[model samples]
Target: MVKSRSETRAHILETAARLLDDEGAAALTIRAVAQAAGLQAPALYRFFEDKDALLDAVAEHVFTTYVTGKAAARDGDPVADLRAGWDAHIGFGVANAALFGLLVTPGRTSPVAEAGLVVLRARVHRIAEAGRLRVPERLAAELVHAAGTGAVLTLLARRPEDRDPGLAEAMFEAVLARILTDAPTPTDTSPDLSKLTVAERALLAEWLDRD
Candidate 1:
């Protein structure tokens, strides 16, 4: 009864991610992961050379997943793309609350950090280009990302009884609106708002006018 290499690796990664979400990164020790995965400590070494390797793998997975989903949301219209992206970000953050917090928290850094930032910047460019985002798109993206990330982190930080689901969703929607309206965009060139159909422009204008 021998597990294939891929199977062993998958089990270890899944077990490690779950432990990280449940108990913070501290619970991802080799022994704990091994016990949780029903494998011995020595068996863990076959998948991950050490805890650093495992943590890096976890960070990479989280980063890649978030970036990929966000990039895919940048479809046709910038406004629609951004709106969809905002929803996706909120959903992912809420669903993977602990892991999302862990990956974004201030103090921790892993091998995935640099690569993640690079990918994030590229995604920002896509949204900025489509939306004709004003200010500086990169700066705007950073701010929007920070606010969105912060909201999710704070929500998860609260006690279970204190959590307010509706309030959180509303807050995200409100912040997203603000970010779209006021965040940096390409101001040097005149925006092609006319590219929108009459009905589309009217709807956009109405949305822009809302408080």
Candidate 2:
């Protein structure tokens, strides 16, 4: 049966991702991917501009799938949600080192990555609203992002047997220690607003207890 354009593109991406996982990026070639997908090399250009473009798409495919799966797993408190995001990012980078490399290539901005930063920003914003954040929201988000990326890349550099399982969590804790505060904000201790309706009071309590 003939495939639609989107279906063909998804098939090509899935095939390329399999090859990337089996062999490192250095060994991946357009011809190989096309052959694996049972398509002529020229046909692949219908969906991708070139090998580099194909790799970028594959990176997006895998990383977006990983993030979507994580999002559906479960919800949590603010701090737990932040840690979950950190762990998911590190896990994806390490598990898909070659694709991760493409996603975070210097001088190349990925929309998928920017979306991830948006999630991080939201998570940090939640903590800030809860009065658990000690630093600025932007700074807190960047710290978590930088730390997660560095930890994953550093671990990927090592032989799997030589990698420390605790390193990623330790880096997360270090970032958290620098950013989180236990003290409540001034408004938390302010005089109660008896004039507030029940619904407003409940919403305010939910926001304050987010951490």
Candidate 3:
């Protein structure tokens, strides 16, 4: 049976992604992908404008799978959700070092990278809505992205046995300390004494009584 055009395109992307994962970015040429997908190089160009476009599609396809799993893992706690996202990002980067490097390489804007940023921003927005974010949502997201990416790259640079196991968690804690409030907004009417000064406590009690 003849495959539909969309199916053919998806097959090409899948083949390319497998090749990328198995052989790294250096092996992702139009000739190589076309050969793997059982298509002529010129025929492959019908779906992708060039080799770079094909690589972008492959990256997007792989990244979508990663992000879908991360989204499914989200629970109600915004802070926990953000932490899970960080762990997911680092895990993906470490496991797919070549793909991650390709996605983050200068001068190339992969949809995969953008999708990851969107997830990060959404997670940060949740914290902002909960009043747990001390920094502006955009800035907070940027900070987290910077730190997470740096941690992943730093870890990837070292030999597996030599890499610091706690590096990612430590970097995350440092970034979290900068972005999150000391405490989330109190749901109950009672004041949190530890977070308030004696004078502030009196003011809060008076305000609570007036409510």
Candidate 4:
């Protein structure tokens, strides 16, 4: 039975995504995908020109879903916007750890990466503009993503017996608060070291003495 072009494309993407989620992105291959989809290896060529093309399609699918959901969750306030985005971003990573891992890992360039960067820049710029941050919006977005990913990695690395969902959520919230609040304000005056306690001064001196 001959399948329609859309059906074939959908099957390929579904198969690829499953492979990505179940076995990591490195396991993705035309032959494996075709076998998973119950199609001959040549049939995959009709949907994707090569393995990179197939991977691009899967990345696009995952990223589009992510970006769209994030966009929908945005509210007008910049602080609130940042909070919501961080929460959703971390939540996605926790829920879809394999897919999230695949998306962020260094790999071939694709439109999926481009699309994610575009949306993230826009969101980060909106927040940075509100705060008059000196760093570029893209840099801010990259930092935010890196921090969130680090937290997710910590959560994922926990042993199954030691994993506590509530504790992880609380820790994520704590980290987000520190990131948003402790970040320097461009025009804010630097605090005087003279005002610190003796212990604080010693700690500061120790830090300053570090290479």
Candidate 5:
């Protein structure tokens, strides 16, 4: 049976992704993908405008799969959710170095990366609503995104054996400390105000001034 247009497109993307994963982006040329997919080079142009377009689609496909899996496995605690997301992001980058590099190349605005950022923003917003976020939600999200991406890139730059096992976790803790409050915002009916020290009171005043 002949494949429909959508089926053919999906097949092409899947083939290209397999080639990319197995051989790296250097081997993901239009001619190479065409040969792998058992189609004429010109036929690939029917689904993708060019090599860059095909690579973008492959990145989107792979990243969408990763994001979908994480979404399905989401935990209930917002903070824990963010931590899990961070770990998953680093793990994906480490496991798929070439694809991760393609998705996060400097100056490239990838749809896949944007989708991940959207999830991060939602998680940060939840933290803010819970009064645990120290910074503005958008700023908190950006900080986390930047730190996470940088951590992955830094680790990927080193030999696998030389990479610090604690690097990603340490970076995450540093970012978290900057963005999350030690406790929920104080309330009128809350525990004794005398429990807070002068330094703690000053920190609370500073937090209130952030708005």
Candidate 6:
């Protein structure tokens, strides 16, 4: 059966991603991808010009998924939110080390990667607005970005069994020490509304914010 353009493109990306995972990025040649995806080599050019272009698309496709889900989930506490983002970033990087390596290559640029940064910056900005962030918002964001990326790369470089289990969290705490103010951030003193439905809790928060 013939597939829609998008469906066909998605199939190619999935097949390429599987190849990348199984055999590394070096195995993602257009011919290899075309064969694995069950399409003629020439048919791939309609979706991607060459191996590099295809790799770029695959990185965006994969990172876009990680960034989307990361952005959707949140911790009410700004500090915890930042930590959660750090954890998620590290997890994604280590899990998809091959694609993550492509992502952080010098001079590489990606909208999905930028979106992840946007989410991190927004989380930092929240702390700054609350007077709990010691550093400038941009600097704080950069610090977190650099440190998180570095932590992931470092862990990826190590043998899985040899990796320090606490390394990522330690890096996060170090960045936090530099960025967060001495004054403790406020706790969620708001009454527990666990009994309320999700929609009801959202409505209540919306009402509270309006006051």
Q: How many clashing pairs per prediction, in order? A: 7, 0, 0, 0, 0, 0
Worst 10 residues of 3 by lDDT: 65-74
- Cα error, residue 111 of model 4, in Å, equals 2.8
Per-residue lDDT tens digits of candidate 5, residues 149-195? 89999999999999999999999999999999999865458667688
- Pitting candidate 2 against candidate 6, the one with the higher TM-score is 2
Error of 5 at 182 (Å): 0.5
lDDT (C-alpha, whole model) for all candidates: 0.71, 0.86, 0.89, 0.72, 0.89, 0.87
Candidate 6 per-residue lDDT over residues 1-211, each given as its tens digit: 8899999999999999989988987888999999999999999999987777898899888877777776646768888888877878898999898888877888977666777788888999888877798778999999999999999999999999999999999988999899988885676788878899999999998998994
Which prediction has more favorable lDDT, 4 or 5? 5
lDDT of 4 by residue, 1-211 (tens): 8878998798788878888888876788899999998989998898789987887788777666766776655588775666676677777777677767666777656676566567666776776666644566666677666677777888788875777667545754654454454454666587777789999999998999999
RMSD of each: 11.4, 8.6, 7.1, 11.9, 9.1, 11.8
Residue 84 shift from truth in candidate 4, angstroms: 2.2
Q: What TM-score do all the candidates reach, one by one?
A: 0.67, 0.80, 0.80, 0.69, 0.80, 0.80
Model 3, 55-91: lDDT tens digits are: 8888888877876775655689999999998998898
Error of 6 at 192 (Å): 40
Candidate number with the higher lDDT (5 or 6): 5
Error of 2 at 49 (Å): 3.4
Off by over 4 Å in 1: 59-74, 111-119, 166-211
Pick by TM-score: 4 or 5, better one: 5
Worst 10 residues of 2 by lDDT: 183-192
Model 5 TM-score is 0.80
Candidate 2: give the clashing pairs. none
Worst 10 residues of 1 by lDDT: 178-187
lDDT-superior candidate, 4 or 6: 6
